[model samples]
Every structure is written in C-alpha cells, then in structure tokens.
Target chain A: MNRHTDTPAGTELLDLPMPEPRTCPFGPAPVYDRLRAEAPVTRVACPTGLTAWLVSRYADVRDVLGDAERFSSRPGQVVHLMAHADPERPIGEGEFTRMDGPEYQRFRRHMGPEISSPRRLAKLRPLVRAVVDERIGALAAAGPPADLYQDFAIPVTTASIGGLVGVPYADRDLFHTAASGVFSDVTDQVQLAAAVRPLQGYLFELVRRRRVEPEDDALSRMVARAPSAEPPFSDVELVAMSAVMLVAGFDSTATALAHGVLALLNDPGQWARLRDDPSLVPGTVEEMVRLFGGGAGIVREATVDTEIGGRPVAKGDYVILAIQSANHDPEAFPDPGRLDVARDTEGHLGFGHGTHQCFGQQTARLELTVALEALVRRVPSLRLAAPLADVPFKTGTSVVGPERVPVTWDEILPAEGEGP
Target chain B: MRVRADTALCVSTGSCALTAPEVFDLGEDDGVVVVLVESPPDEQRETVGRAVRACPAGVLSLAP
Candidate 1:
C-alpha cells in the first residue's frame, strides 16, 4: 500500500523528488525553476514515497512557513523525508520546533533568552574569534591542501557550540558523532533509532547534571530559567531542548561555513575582494547564506483548508516550502544564480520567516564573519586543491555541504607580530 | 518617515538590526525588537526601509 496513491480526490500529483539532488552545487535542482515557473504549489511525490504539496514561489513559501495557524509544524502533520518514514512520534519531540501555538511559545520563551539575546551573543564574539584563530593557526601549521570543512569548519563550529551548550571538550567527539547522524539521510526506523539513542541518553545525563550544578553555559541557564515559566518544563523536555539546540547549532553553522568557503573559492574575484576588505565579511556571509543555505525545505501541515499561491490546500495535507528555490527566485532577486557578496540580501529566507525564524541566526552570522575574515587575512592565496566538480557533496542529509573542501595556498603566512 | 515596531509581533530574529544596525536593536531583557530611531533622516531612510522589509515577523512599519 504505497502512500503516494492515497492522495485525496481533486489533488494533482507530479512525480518530483524532494531534497532533489543538486546538479549544480550552488543551486537547487533544476526542477524547482520549472515548478516556480508553472505550478508554484503542486502535489509532488516526496522522496519518502508520500505525496506532498511542494511550494516553490518566494511569496507562497513565505506564506506557508509564516502562518503557523494555517500550517502546523507538528511531526506527522508536516511530513518530510524522515517523518514520512516514521510518523509514530513527532520529530524533535518536546523541542519547540514541533510544537504549535502556546506550547511552542512557552518553550521558545524559556529557551530564547539563553541563545538569542544580543548581549549573550555579543559576549560570545571574542571567544568565537579566538576559536576561529586557533583553528586557522592549526590549519596554517598543517600547511596547505587541507580539508577546510573537516579540519576548520567542523571543529570551530562544534567547539564553539559545545562550549556554549556545556558539552565537555572530552566528550565533544562523541557528541558530534551522535548528533551528526540526526540529520543524515537515513530513514529506516531501526537506523534512525540507533542514531538518536546515544544523543538522547547523553543529553538526558547532561540535563540532570545541569540541574544539580549549573554552569554559565546556555544549557545551565535554560535549566535555571525553566521552572519560572508559566508552565514549567519537565526534565525530559529540557533534555529534548538541549538535543535540538546541539544539533541545530552544530549542523547548520558547520554546513554554512563549509559551503561559504566553497562559494568563495568558486569565485576568486570575490575571494580577492573579501581578502582586500575585511569589512565586507558581514555582507559576504549574508550573501553566502542566501545563495548556498541548504535544507530540503521548510515543512508544514495544513491545519485548516487554506489557499497557498491561490491553490487550494486541504487540511492535514503536507506542504514542503522549497526554501532554496524561494531564496533563488528571480522574482525576489535579480540574477539569482549569480553570487554577489555586495548584493543586498534583505528578505532572504536563509534564516526563515515568522516566529519560527532561527533564533540563533545572529550567532551563526558572527561565527561566519569572524572565520571568513580570519581565513582571508591569514591565507589570501587560498584556492581549491581539487577541481570544483571533483569535490564530493553530502546527500541524503537535511542540510547539504561539501564532504571535504580541499583547499591549498602558496606560502604560509606567519601569525601577526611573529618574527620571520 | 516615522518608524514604529509592533513589539507584540516581534520575534526578535534580529534581521532588522542586521539590516540597519543604526536604527534598530534587540532588547536586552526580552529579546524583542527595539526602535532606536523614531524618525530617520533622509540618509538613513533606505536602509531603514530594508530593515523594515527584512523583519520576518512583520513587526516594523513606516508612516509618513
């Protein structure tokens, strides 16, 4: 009994794969351009063998992601790759990501201040900068032809996020190993369970520890603040919150950093421009995010029969908001295919929209800015060691990035003030 | 242009601040949008407009 055949009457189904593998690393599957041109909101066969309404246009995608009332983020309600395979439990259970209305608001209210506060994130900048510098220093010592994705982006992102979340440096590898699988393309029930179990156990223990002896990190602050909320969070809920934060923090930023490097490396002129002017780092980061930010798309379930881009959507129908397509929509952005660091990326859906917009976006931006500035300043001659087409890209993952960005440079520049 | 933010609707994604740092910021206590410039000079109007449009939550609006 294939779920694809179970679509309600009056809905049209088109055979289109979700998370459509990219032929070009910088853009989404070419099919999205066709969809945006013709059927902006049409039923399509998801990769999981279920049928979902794939929303492609910029305005339509925003409308779906933004209207939590009309569209629900609850697990089974919004079917994605993994959720389609396993609908018994909510994805990111107890995490605000799956919650709606007051329940979501409650959890977000408690967790928001700890991670998203400008003051808290501002204080993290120097520490983040130090991490970037230390990582770059190691890369310099290792010489050129290093995988920036693995050696540089992964470590800096994991360490900075781990530090904030109170994940012990000793347990960092174990934490990352377990957390990384949570976003993998794996959809088998047993395989998914196996991937998530260790992470769940680790976070449960960490939450218990934070409860007893709190630290200055985000986890401790969340624990301390949880009890004061209108409807206090349970231990299990807090554990889930930590798990969500850890995965979200590490995976998205790591991908962005790695992909940002790949984007810059692809355009030597842009790379040179950035190297010449460090002030462009912030705008460059935004541009990279707009151009290269990857996710299958935002998923939402129709809570009530609604109209998306003037197309009727029935209640309980799954809607996949193709964010990458929307970000690259020619309507919203002129010459959307081109990467312009100086382009005003205002209103890009990279961080998403509405109440569900990424709360930690500022933190991600800060990390990217500091890291890119440091890389260009330290190694202005850095270029891809391998041909761009030869580089492997990660598939079957919610967020996409280079498997390894093998980059090389001419001469290793000495640390500032060090004798030659 | 007079700029006002509907604090009730603000999600504090900080897009406005990132778009126009001189005109907007997030509150220290609640992390909601804070309007730093009520009336912007001509020089800052375009950036402020971008900031208003960049706001995901539709909290920012301009009045003549």
Candidate 2:
C-alpha cells in the first residue's frame, strides 16, 4: 500500500488509505505529489454512497477547513469513517465537535478553560512529565526487547488522557479498555453499542458525581458551567463531551507518540542528535508529529455552492481535506520529505485548522514534549528492534501509526536527581 | 505591525504562542490568545507574521 503505483487505470477513483498508502514511510505517498501536481481536487467515491472532492493542495485544504460558514463539519468525522457499515454516530448533546455555529461555540467556550487554556496546559505539564517518566521507568523495569507502542507509549498517553478527563488511577484500566472499545474498528451496531454502553454509563455516573462535588478537572469544570449555560446544560451533555475527549483524544495522541518515536528512531542521526541536545526535543516533537503524527484527514461537507481552487463544488458536496498531503505539500514545506528538527514546523495542518480544530492539541503537545524528552534522556541507548519497513503500520484503523514499535535498550540511564 | 486577537474565535491550538512567543501567549485561565506585544519590534516582524499565519482559527491579525 506504500506507493499506490498500480497505475490508476485512469478511472479508479481514490479510496481509503489516502496519504500513506506512501512510497516512503518518512513522508506521505507519492500519489499525493502526482495528485497535487495533476489534479489537487479530484473525486473520491466513498463507501457511504457519497462523493467526496478530495482536496490535496495546502492552501485549498486550509481554505476549506478555515471557512466553517461555507464548509460545514455537520456530517462529522463519521463521513470519513463511514465505511464497512460504520454506523453514523449520533452527535450527542454536548458533542460540539460535530456541531455548527453557536451550539458548537457554546460548548467550546465552556470546555476551553479546563481542557486547553494556557492555564490548563501549565497545570497539566507536571502531570504529563510524572506520568511519562513513570511509564518509561516501568518500561525499563520490564526490561528491553519491548513494544514501546503497547508498553510505554500507550500507557503514558492513556494516563495523560486520564488526567485530562479526570479518570482516577485505579479506574484507568476500565477506562482504557472502554476507551479503546469506543474507538475500536467494530462497526456492527450490536458490538458498537456493547462497547459504548458501559463507557457511557460510567461517564454518566462520573458527570453526576462531578455535579455533586466538583473536582479540579475538565468534567468538573463542565459541571460548574452547566447551570450558567445559555440554554442550560444537562448532565447527559457533560458525559457526552467527556466521551468526545476520550474518543477523540485517546487513539490519536497514542499513535502520534508511537509514530513520532518510530520516525525519530528510524533516522539514527536524528535520534543521536536529539539524545545529545535535549533542547532540540521540542522542535523535534513538532517535526516528527508533522511528518509522522497528526490526525487522519478531516471531512467537511459544503453547505453552499463553493469552488475549491476554481473547481466547481456544488452545495451538499463533501470535501476530504488530505491533511497529511497538505503537510507534505512542497509549496508550504520546502523539502517536505526531509525531517529538519529546527525547521519552522509551525502551521502544519497536523492538528487541523479553523473553528473546529483539535480540542486536545495542547495536551497532545505536552504529552509528546515530556514523553520524547524523557524517553531520549532516560533511554539514551534506545534503538528500534525492527526496521521501519518491517514494522507494521496501522493503515487498517483511522488513526495511522506503527502498530507495535518494538525497541531494545542496552542500559537504563538515570536522571539528574536520581541515584547513579 | 500591530496585532489583534479575537479570543471568541480561538480554539487555543496555541500556534501563535509557540510561533511568536514574544508577541503572543495563551491566557493562563481561559487559554485564549493574549497579545504580549501589540506592536512587535522590527526583529520580531517575520515571526509575528508566522504566528498569525499559524493560527488555524484565524484569531490573530496584523495591521501595518
């Protein structure tokens, strides 16, 4: 699925596996280069009986995502996931991610302080660091020849997510399994509901608890916000929003960590460079996530007649913003193939754009920053146990990354304060 | 150039703060964009431009 070089019989419209389905693991598919160069906006036949105008160019994709008025996100992410009988997700009461206009803004504003405010990020920093370091320590204790994806990366991210959504330490196991189930590939209504029911019940109870006694977390913050809500928010709405944070934040952040680690370790020079200069970790986080992380492409349905790059897109048309392709767009990123740690990686469409941008991006950044910085600092001898090509990547799921980042380290490196 | 930020529109992606730390920051409590240097110096003009461009929400704008 790497190159997509099967010579598009000229009529074979694009299907799933949009970006990588790449010639190189380090960058996006060459098909993107050809498509962007040839036809930036082309028709894509979706399994959901929909026709999506796949926008590949950087500016055009940005335009579509930025302009919420013309391009509506109401059809929601399910449009992207609406394959293999994946049922349409009912946009819950407080699930603003799928909403439009004022309804969406109300939730975004209410939850903004708890989840993404600068204050929240600062508050979250220490938690993220402690969690990351603890996870790495566990990884080291478990010994090398480990799967970083499962053992270290996922747990750190899971805990970080727990911190954000206010899942207690003892409850993380139940929360983690349920979180994975909700984001799981199971599309059958019976199976999906089986997964959703328990998690929903747990969240509903949690929200109810938060109402009774507010905690210093996102859910509690929302509970406090409920009474003053314009139309008055309900407990159900709070639970739904918490699920949104869980479902949206969980798999993507974990994958980013795994993918970023793979991207760095794949290039030894870059790995060594990062290990040498800890200061490079922050910029390196941006670069790696730009190349290897970010969410799956965003789906926006046009509300009114619009033209993308002069292409006539009638109202009701769907547009798949190929974010990975846009990130690799040479026009926006010079030598986009090369991973330059110091490169100005700002404005990479990794976290997406506009009013409906990723809600957990700052949290993701904090996790990535602490995890990568600590991983390099703690495991200086870290090396991939398997080559990137041999390492199976997750193209099957909506969240793309190495399925299992197997790595081996020679010794456990101690921190400055710890006993040598 | 003078900068203006509309907190109402901010999703708090924090790109502005990350891009031009001197010119912009995220508010401690609300996480909306806070303009540090409303009019940045000559040395920071390019970074400021980038910070504005980097904002996905179109929350930041520069006036010459």
Task: Give per-residue lDDT, candidate 1, residue A323.
Answer: 85
Q: Model 1, stretches more than 4 Å misplaced?
A: A1-12, A18-22, A76-78, A83-93, A414-420, B1-5, B17-30, B34-48
Clashing pairs in 1: A185-A396
For the predicted complex of model 1, DockQ is 0.43
Q: What is the DockQ of each candidate?
A: 0.43, 0.48
- The residue-by-residue lDDT of candidate 1 on A1-420, one tens digit each, is 243346657666887544433466888778888889988988888666666788888999888777888988774422466532543365554757777766676666566566665567778888788888788779878877899888999889888888888886577766566555666656565665676778788888888888899888888888877786667778888887777777778768988988888888989999888888888889999898888664567677778877898887777677888888999999999999788878888778888787787767877888888888888888888899988888888876777778888899887565556555
Interface RMSD of each: 2.5, 2.7
Assess the local accuracy of residue A211 in candidate 1 as a C-alpha lDDT between 0 and 100: 86
Clash totals for all models, in order? Answer: 1, 4
Give the fraction of native contacts in model 2.
Answer: 0.47
Model 2 ranges off by over 4 Å: A1-12, A16-23, A84-90, A173-175, B17-48
Candidate 2: tens digits of C-alpha lDDT, residues A22-108: 357666667788889998988776555555778888899888888999998877664555343321356656657778776787767
